[model samples]
Target: MPPAEKTAWDLARAATHANLPLLGTPMSQVVDRLLSARIRQNAFKVRPATRAGVMVSGGGYQGKTETVCEIAAVFEDSWRELHGSHPETVPGSRDLWAPVAYVQTPVTAKPKSTCKAILDFYGAPTKGMDLPELIRQVAASLNDHGTKVLVLDDITRLRMHRADDQDTLDLIRAFMSMHVTLVLVGVDIPGSGLLREGRGRGGKSVNGWEPTQTERRFDLVELDRFRYDTDEQITAWTTHLAGIENALRLLDARPGMLTEGRMPEYLFARTNGVVGLLERLIEDGSTEAIVTGTERLTEPLLDSLPLTLADSVGRDVAAGEVPALPAASRQPGTRPGRRRNTSFDDRGSAASTA
Candidate 1:
């Protein structure tokens, strides 16, 4: 039904579907396992050694930041549970206990700017403070607030060519020296010059330049796109689609609307197996389905919806051509045939020839 025809209740349900919570995937599971283990181990250690950190790196729309943030939030929830929800405050001090501090690396990030971002998270003042003072304040705040995990998102913005950016990177490395677990989220971190050692005076190479201490202490993990080349990969991809299908609320949407027949292949072609792009496609398709009275996701309906510029350019580069979806296999009951050729028939033919 069109918007004009939709009852108020129908419109309300559509809105709910549009804002569904983040669906779990295999990639998220891996990240959750690794990050959660690191945070848990760091929590128990009483030693003064610098705690290790995690760096989540991936291409655009891979949900690196969301996944890490969600994990950090989970850790905070448990940490607060173990400790009391409210701690006692001194007569002159504020009663603030933040187990997790999340901040974005400024676009024009410097050492002072980075420190200010962390202090800002704690609502601490940084006015008229120099670099050293700001750094000291940041450490003090972390200690006072009992912060166990600090997430620095969009860390790739700090390119290493400039002196300020190099100092910003060093400042982040110093954060690792504290007891807190530092989580850095960025795009293409390996190529972002973050892992490399800084240059000496006049941009000259330092003697025996090697991987920075930050790189050594931080374990880099990638949130990769879904793959469909093998049986296991295909199963994982289809399982992910099923989770999305289960979450959708369209009246006419059937169980296998997204996972059945060529729909899976078509969605993969459209989204290149990126979860963010897949969610966008589904969200838009669901809205159109609700509006046009179709109430179901069909290939034609999805194709008619305009492609996001990123998805369009990425699909073009990856597939090289528009993939053709079989018209007959679009129905919910239909199943796509095996992608691999049958070896039994080939063997029979070879035996006959012999």
Candidate 2:
């Protein structure tokens, strides 16, 4: 084979292998065991209206994006892994055989956060020239496929960084009406009046919040914070977190500085166990380390991380910033912030978080 051809083949093979068992999507054991079955069931039950949803609630980090992307990659790459790779030139229409997964994250920094804004993403017919039409075009175009997974990241963005359980729930229901497999990620605790909607208009079954169709074709998967004290699990979710940062850093740029021979122990120590914060911390750490020589990741460098991270970490751990946190728990440079999510150290996996 030509050298370039050989390289492409090798790269494709590597991509296929890394996604085996698809480690990215955070799934409950029940969902994991029945993904294929559930997909098939929904495929048959709802042609224009299938609906399965998962709501992962935790601090802003915890591998949520990693988890979701992995699942998307799984659906995207499964074909090549199962069938031999065709030339990249194959038209996405004629040669495309794998299930196409459409991703629509309507959560943006825009000021309009209304049902019209969201329904637009769902592809509902919109005649007016506005955000709603853009969303509608996106939703319809993406959902046109036979089998697809639509992921809306940070759905809570609609409520301005506040958790609106009703908005979340309503959006999920709306997406269900569209017959799409959905995954929604956001923080816990409702910041909007969405919770009021979920309570149902009195005397209605909570689960009765189903589609108006003849059948129910979806399941619920809830992602929770890793329980720290499970009998089988350890309390130091920090260790697991340390490994995550170390791996990302090692795989990321500046490999030698952070991983060279050892691990990012400080990376783990500082962020505790929040994946979002840990990622930001590591990213900030790597950027600084790369530019600075990183003699060793120190308290001073960590303190200089971006404001988003600083604010995020601060909100999690400070009860009033009483005593300065010990090195093991404190991210450097900054004063004590808010208390963090309790760490989970047991042999606990994401599945255990439920």
Query: Model 2 over residues 1-354: C-alpha lDDT tens digits?
Result: 897985675456434323323122223333344444444345446356446655443445555445655555655575356545533333455433324443333433242344344445444454564655654554555444333556655544444233453344444556566655565554442332132343333221454553322113333344443433432223234344434334442222443444323233444345543445555565556556545655245556776764253444422232111112224444432222334344553656566555
Error of 2 at 174 (Å): 4.8
Residue pairs in clash, model 1: 1-293
**Every model's TM-score:** 0.81, 0.50
Compute the lDDT of residue 331 as modeled in candidate 2.
44
| Candidate 1 per-residue lDDT over residues 1-354, each given as its tens digit | 665666786778677777767877888888899999999899777798899999988776777878998888898899888876534334577658888899988878888889998899988999999988998999888878778899998888776788899888878888887789989987767766677644422211344556567668898888887887778888999998898888888889888999988788888777777777778888888889878979999899998986563444423222111223223223342224334445444444344554
lDDT of 2: 0.44
Off by over 4 Å in 1: 1-6, 86-92, 198-211, 309-354
RMSD of 1: 7.0
